[model samples]
Target: MYNSVSEKDWVEAAHPVSQNVRSDIAGAGCDKPYFEPLIPEERPDIDSPYFVYFGRIHEDKGCKTLIEYFKHFKQKSSNKVKLVLIGKNFMNEVDTSDDIIYTGFISDQKKSFYLQNSIGLIIPSPYESLSMVTLEAMIEGKPVLVNGYCDMLKKHIELSHAGYAYFNKEEFCDSLNKLFTMTEKEKAIMSKNGIAYIEANYNWKVIIDKYKYVIENITKP
Candidate 1:
């Protein structure tokens, strides 16, 4: 499959193939960020650590990949790692494991709690037409570790210096190890970079200027 496309078609979908084609070209273009606003009631204590997975729970979307790798990560690290699975089930018996919350189709408020609290996300999809999950992850200001196979997210991760993308299950495990290995200094820097990248590129507030250019050009005679 082609890895990229023109900017024109990214947001301008003339037909069904339009969005898919645009996703290739534009690479999660200036879509809205997925950061959830924090509510007072559900905010976890600031010190607790967690990870989240948002989007469909289908096989291709990497639900299984996160489950298996997190199981291994839990075995390898003493750090408390909570996995919040947010969305409807796309398969059967995804897991029977510790600290795994399969909240079937989370509400908006619950989603914001997870978004505000979690360390980051594990997006292991081998293939996606386009990952709205990645878009939201970056928007939410959470770092993401996705699969290298998803060319769309790979481009964003590389361009925005946002997060890591593992190629195989082993690589996924290695990514987990790397996260644990990070010193507070390093994590802080990466977190700064992540937030900076979103502010500059993904945050809808700053980059809506892109739309003006798009509109100017598209409406030009």
Candidate 2:
């Protein structure tokens, strides 16, 4: 079983025998897979608070680039949006500012709170099999800004219309600007679209059904 389409392709290329097996795509489900009942609740103004990057803080994860693009955005725009980093740091060169906060190794409960309140989630990693953090953010009705080099992440953004994908610094800054300037109604629509997409594609019920089908086929005579 593969967690993503890209993973399946990679495995088949590396091991020819993988082609004979019932290779399938079963995406890693969100940590908080179930959506909350939609009730009228006050959410923070989109431009008032911050955007978040929650994952391993390392060079491969593109933490440094994310920080640089965020700084560039803040310097160019009047928007007071902050960037919050939530994970353990493996990168030595990262620095924090009044606009950037590092909350190293937060609890899952705290992580969910940040996801729920943030303007959006930024995943700068250029490589991912499947990003659970991105799905978790969507479950909370938040948009995601992902790196375009990763086909899996790009596919998620395109199929769901849940967020933006950036391939360069200019595109990264542009996406941040666009997300910040969106109207409340537009943000709400994006959020709704993301939640619906996850429910249809990544929810446990859908994943379980896929697994059952694969198992039944393999077990059949």
Candidate 3:
């Protein structure tokens, strides 16, 4: 099985492709076993009201765009929200101040600590093969703001209704504002929607069942 429909299509488009070959796409499963639910005391002492990015601070991942837009959003918006990045700094562009904090690389438990309490997850990558980080965020019941240019990310938001997908800086900033202003009930609904989507689509049990079915079919006499 392929990790994404895009990968499946690309494989099919290769020169001298065989029509006899069949392909199916499945998203990467969440690491729910590693991310055990945290008690309040176990949570980190990080400041509140922040959005998080959970991958490399590289240009290809759209880190530059996310950082620029977030700073822009902060400049105009009165709310004292922040942007927390929880990955290795590859780009070296971030100033690493309170408004845009960068925690080089941290443990999974600490990553969960930040993600579980953040305003939402932001994935601005223009390319992704079914982003595992996005699935992780959703499984944690947090809404996501993803790049609309990435088909996989956009499809996740579309299928799940758990967040927004922005194509440009204006939309990105606007989504940040919207997420910040949402009422508790609205936020809860979005959170619930994300959790339900992840459980139905990317849960390990469901993914394992899919693999079993595929294996059984291929092994049939």
Best model number under TM-score: 3
For residues 31-120, could you state the per-residue lDDT of candidate 3 as single tens digits? 553667778787766765899999889988999888888888888888889899888888857767778888889988888778877999
The digit string of per-residue lDDT tens for model 2 on 85-104 reads 98999998668987988889
Order of quality (lDDT)? 3, 2, 1
Instruction: Write down the lDDT of every candidate, Cα atoms only.
Output: 0.66, 0.83, 0.84
The Cα error of candidate 2 at residue 22, in Å, is: 5.3
State the displacement of the C-alpha of residue 86, model 3, in Å, after optimal TM-score superposition.
1.1
Candidate 3 collision pairs: none
lDDT preference between candidates 1 and 2, better one: 2
TM-score per candidate, chains pooled? 0.72, 0.85, 0.86
Please give the lDDT score at residue 125 for candidate 3: 96
For model 3, the stretches where C-alpha displacement exceeds 4 angstroms are 9-23, 31-45, 219-221
The best-first sequence of candidates by TM-score reads: 3, 2, 1
Model 1 C-alpha RMSD to native: 5.9
- For model 1, what is the alpha-carbon lDDT of residue 49? 68
Q: Candidate 1 at 162: error in angstroms?
A: 2.3
